[model samples]
Target: MIVKMLHDAGLRSEHAYLGAAASIGLSLASWLASNRQENLERADRWGIFVGEWAPTFFGLGLALANYERTDGEQLIDSQ
Candidate 1:
């Protein structure tokens, strides 16, 4: 249902995968920024919080990929 909704909403697997990648980058950036501005504990918390999003995005990407494969939309191109 979520995959269908995402598809209907025009969100492809690549978008989720890109979001996952961006989340990782954001996690690092957040950690660095917090470390510089705040402290190690805050930085760790920020990193952990942002880092957790990657898996959810990756899971959504996988689900969308499977949906695309079964539905034959080819929304995400192999490259």
Candidate 2:
């Protein structure tokens, strides 16, 4: 199920790169916004947390998808 989700989201290098890039952008926005306001810590926290997760998710997606292709199946490396 997770593999299918990643595949449908275009987990190739191109998409992974995009996801990572987006994550950075979100993180920046989160940080900047967090520093600008005093009553929006939750929003800032949410954005920052989610943003941080994006890069890792995209990176894993890339590695798994590539592994799948190399193995001629959706078999990701266990390393």
Candidate 3:
């Protein structure tokens, strides 16, 4: 259902994949910034929190790709 909603909303697998990649960079940046501006513990927490989002986005990308493949006919027809 979520995949269908994402597809219907025009969110492709590429977008989700890109988001995952971006999240990784953001996580790194956050870690570095927090480490410099705050403390080691705070930086670790920030990095872990942001790093977790990558997996969810990757999962979403996979799901969307599968949805696109399985429902390609219908999607193309609609378009």
Candidate 4:
């Protein structure tokens, strides 16, 4: 139901996928930037924190893609 609402509200699987990819890039960038100014542990923590978001985004993308496919199937079946 939540995925359906998100889809209706203009959130697509592609967007989620892109977000995941961007999160990965951001995580790498943050780690590189923080490593220069902070201790290894702190820099690793920053990367880990940002890296966690990628899985959530990837999950959302999968859910949205499944919802879109099912929704399309329903439409075709109804016709």
Candidate 5:
């Protein structure tokens, strides 16, 4: 249901996948930037926090893709 609502709102699987990729880059950038200004522990924490988002985004992307596939199958069958 949530996936359908997200799809209806124009949020596709590609967007989620892209977001996951971007999050990984952002995490690396954040780690580098923070390492220059803060302690190593803090930098590691910052990187880890940002890195965690990638998994959620990936999961969403998979769910959306599955939904799209099944939905497409239903549409074809109904015709």
Candidate 6:
């Protein structure tokens, strides 16, 4: 129901959480893939650490779906 909260609060799905999900996933994936190149230092390690945020994004997407009105939040919406 988080998404409904966001929506009721005047936030658009595609503009906020949805966009955040895509952005975080892409960033995390790229960071993870790039980390396999060589010995990464502390900063690079931090990058990899930060790259693991994709699942959180996905979870937020789930919350958004749960907040949906129709059919108890269909997961297969027009994503």
Alpha-carbon deviation at 67 in model 1, angstroms: 0.3
lDDT of 6 by residue, 1-79 (tens): 5566676886543444565566666666666666676555643665656555655556665665555545344655754
lDDT by residue for model 2 (1-79), tens: 6655666666665666677788878787877777677457776776778688776867676776675677565345554
Clashes of 1: 0
- Candidates' lDDT values, in order? 0.94, 0.70, 0.95, 0.98, 0.98, 0.59
* Model 1 Cα lDDT, one tens digit per residue, 1-79: 8789989999999999999999999999999999999989999999999999999999999999999887875544432
What is candidate 4's lDDT per residue for 6-31, written digit by digit as tens? 99999999999999999999999999
Using Cα atoms with residue i matched to residue i, what is each candidate's TM-score against the true structure?
0.89, 0.53, 0.90, 0.96, 0.97, 0.44
Best of the two (1, 6) by TM-score? 1
Residue lDDT tens for model 5, 1-79: 8999999999999999999999999999999999999999999999999999999999999999999999999999999
Model with the higher TM-score, candidate 1 or 3: 3
Give candidate 4 regions above 4 Å deviation: none
Model 1 clashing residue pairs (backbone)? none
Clashes of each: 0, 0, 0, 0, 0, 1
Off by over 4 Å in 5: none
Show model 2 residue runs off by greater than 4 Å. Answer: 8-11, 39-48, 71-79
**On a 0 to 100 scale, what is the lDDT of residue 23 in model 4?**
99
In model 6, the clashing pairs are 1-67
